[model samples]
Target: MLHALINGLGLGLLLAIAVGPIIFSIIKISLGYGKKAGYAFITGVCLCDALLILLGNVAAEVMRSALEYKNLIGIIGGCLFIIMGIYSFFFGKKPDFEKSRDIQVDYRKRDMAKFTLQGFFINLFNPGPLLFWLTTCTTYSFLNTNERILLFSTTLAVVFLTDFLKVNLAQKIKRWLTPPNLAKLHKATALILTLCGVIIASSVILKNFISW
Candidate 1:
C-alpha cells in the first residue's frame, strides 16, 4: 500500500510541475476574482483529475494488453507536452487586470457555480491533462492494483494541494511585479515550457530509435 501510494504521488507531481495552460488559467482567474476563486477552480481541476484517474483504472482493467505499449503512451504524451510548450512560448496569456484592488462585483461571489463548472471543463477539455494521464496513469496502474489506486489518489491529492498553493502564490507574487518584470516572467515561463517540450520530444525520439 505504501509503495503504491508513494509511486502514484511521485508520478503525478512530475507532470504537475510544468507551467501548463491549466496553471496559467488558475493565475488568470485568480487575478480577476480572488484567491478563493482561484482555489475553487483548482478544486474543480482536482475533481477532473480524479475522474481521469478513474477512467484510466477502468481502461487498464478493460485493456490490460494496452498497458504494455509504453512507446505509444510516451509518443502521445510527448506530443501533447511538445504542443503545449509551443503554445505557451508563442501565445500564452497571463491575467489582465487594470487595477490591483479586487473587482467590486458581488454577483461573481454568489454565482460560483459557473466559475467552478468552467474551471472543471477547462481542465477536462484541455489536452495536457489527458496526455499527462495517458502516460502517468498507465504507469501507476502497472503497479499492484490496490497499491496503485491508493498511490494515485494520494499523489493526486498532493498535486492538487501544491498546484493550488502555486497558483495563489503566483497571484500574490504578480502583484509586486512591474509590467516589464511581469512580461519578463511570462517570457521565462514560455522558455521553460519550450524546454519541457524539447525534453519530452527527445525522450520519444530516443525510445523510437532504440526500438529499431
Candidate 2:
C-alpha cells in the first residue's frame, strides 16, 4: 500500500507538471471564463484520464508489449514537449482581456457542459496521456487488483489537487496579467517543458543502458 501510494504520488506529480495543452487550456479558461469554467474543463480532463487508465488496465498485455518501445516513445514525447515549450516561449502572446469581460453573465450551464466536452476531447486526442497510462499500467502490473486501484486512485487525487491549485492560482493572477508578467509566465512554462523533456528522455536512456 505504501509503495503504491509513493509510486502513485510520483506519477501524479509528473502528470500534473507535464507541459501539455491541457495545463495551458486550464489556465486560459480560468483567465477567460473564470473558475467555474476551469473547474468544468478539468473535470472532463480527469474523467478522460480515468477512462484511459481503465482501458490501459484492461489491455495490459498489449500495453506491456508496447513497453518494449517505451524508450523511443518517451524520447519522442519529451522532444515534442520541448519543441512546444520553445515555441510558446518565443511566440506566446499576452492575454487579451477584451474577450474575457462579463464572464459571469455569459457563462451558463450549457457553456459549462460545452467546456467539459471540450476538455474531454482535448485530453482524449492527446496521445501523451494514453501512452503515459499504458506505461504506468504495464510497469505496475505486479500489483494486485486492489493495490492497483489504490495506486491509481492516489494518482488521480494528486492530479486533481494540482489542477485545482492551478485554477486558483490562475484566477488570483488575473489582475497582474501585464505584458511583462505574461512574458515571464510563458518563459517559465517553456523552461518547465524543456526540463520535463530532458528528464523523460534521460530516464529512458538510463533505463536502456544502465541495466536498472
Q: How many clashes in each structure?
A: 2, 0
Supply the global lDDT for candidate 2.
0.73
- Residue pairs with backbone atoms closer than 3 Å in model 1 (clashes): 5-151, 9-155
What lDDT is reached at residue 80 by model 2?
Answer: 66
Q: Rate the local accuracy (lDDT) of all candidates.
A: 0.65, 0.73
Q: What are the per-residue Cα lDDT tens digits for candidate 2 across 47-154?
A: 999999999888665544676566666577567656756766677554454443322335675668888887788899987688667656765654668889999999
Q: What is the lDDT of residue 161 in candidate 1?
A: 79
RMSD, candidate 2, Å: 5.6
Clash count, predicted structure 1 = 2
Off by over 4 Å in 2: 61-109, 171-212
